[model samples]
Target: SSPPSYQNGLWGHVGKTKTPEDVDALVGPRPGLKGEGHLFDRLSKNRDAVVVLDEIEKAHPAMINEFLLGVLGNGQMQNKKTGETIDIGKSIFILTSNCFQTMITHRYRQEKDDVAALESLHSSLANTIRTWVHSGVSASGKGE
Candidate 1:
């Protein structure tokens, strides 16, 4: 099997799980955000996934934090939008960010209360990519 695809906009619409009755539905997934779905979650769900978020920090800080915690591991997201709450169930999450150092610093700075350790790990991986880029080993290292 190849993959599935959703033809909506960048961030697809929230399903009918949040029906305007549940208080938690109003809260959404990303804490205080309105629409409750992560772009990474959406992309990961696609069949032929090639997701790329350039400056990930520019997105809702809280959303990013929530995503780093909830979805990135096994690509699971709980959407509290439908007044009831729904889960993406399965996703193929891929993320990119420029705030590599910042995330790491924040995680190390608050190891006790940091819920985004995986975010820190992702940032560290980004740093590794940067190192590869700087050392000219990322793309050109393929024997050129």
Candidate 2:
């Protein structure tokens, strides 16, 4: 049988990974970072790779705002500790989360309109994502 996709390797309980150094370990580290291999580099070697990041809401905020911005925005991950950049333009990352479900259920539980609830939830989530993307100290020069 074919092996599971590399995306299947993410460890749970991501809140402990506090900084960019921890972010490098979570994404996978390179020799330059004092580690053996990088998942982004490995996946990029494939002609087509779909990377899945499950439970994204649980990840450390620093990793998202600091490390992930470079990769998700520019298709390049700059490992601040190692001063190495890994090219991730070829991979597609699917991020999944269940965090909003509870809020949606509780907030609109009394309402009977499913469509409205969904729309409201979408707007809230979009605003939250916008805040997270722009909350950093420096603005991203590269346009999305």
Candidate 3:
């Protein structure tokens, strides 16, 4: 299925989130500033916004566990610096990755039916993501 269209939102690339401060820059308040981060700033202004995090697989495990888990699970995130909160209950989050593109492409090519191939890919990807989330490690066996 295709991703939903959003009239408002913010986009971020995880390649830039190599440190805790980077995560804060995306989701929390900027250091030494009263204003919110890019994502939170947009979210605060537009409650129905969508947030797209590209290359999510590249984010550090601490970011996934400490920051994303809170935002995703609670639909809200707090700025540690400013002691402010951003409610994301009405927002949508889209996480994109190319972690297993080669394997997915190979599997798709091996399948005869397109529907079946997509279904299989979906299931496999879901299972892999579940494993990664539970284990706090990625396919490359590197994370926390």
Candidate 4:
């Protein structure tokens, strides 16, 4: 279960990322703002909090390769500016994306069997997302 005001932590406008600094702002403490980063600050206040990073596919490559890899792989991240280690082991992260919505919808409409369509879509989406994440290129074939 999530907190009632979980919407407060929604990161809907995580726009283009040009540098590591942008990644820091999302997961680590900001450059000059002491102890202030969206994910870090939310987890610091409430370990049970649920944070949503909407449209994750739009995030920069550095964000996926650097911050997300560390967080998802290790369950923790170091605050670059504060030199503090933030543990995300207890926090719930919800990543949302519409990368293949159209394809999925079209497949479902064209396919007669629901189970087969779901299986095919699942396999395709998984492989595509895995490739995009590892190769630093988005599903759109655009390098961020």
Q: Give the best candidate by TM-score.
A: 3
- Maximum-lDDT candidate: 3
lDDT of 2: 0.56
Off by over 4 Å in 3: 1-7, 29-36, 114-118, 138-144
lDDT of 3 by residue, 2-89 (tens): 2233578677886557876777667664558554466666677887887788887788665688777778899887766777887779
TM-score of each: 0.34, 0.62, 0.79, 0.75
Model 1, 96: alpha-carbon shift in Å? 2.7
By TM-score: ranked, best first = 3, 4, 2, 1
lDDT of 2 by residue, 9-127 (tens): 42223444555555565655544566522444454355246666655555666556655676789987654445566676766776666666777677777664778776877798789
20 in model 1: Cα distance from truth in Å? 18
Alpha carbon lDDT of each predicted model: 0.41, 0.56, 0.72, 0.66
- Give candidate 1 regions above 4 Å deviation: 1-48, 83-91, 98-144
Lowest lDDT sum, 10 consecutive residues, model 2, at 135-144
Which regions of candidate 4 are displaced past 4 Å? 1-12, 16-21, 29-35, 138-144
Tens-digit lDDT track of model 1 for 1-144? 111344632322222212332222322443465543444344434534443433333333333334434445444445544433334344334444443566567666778466577666767676776564344432322211
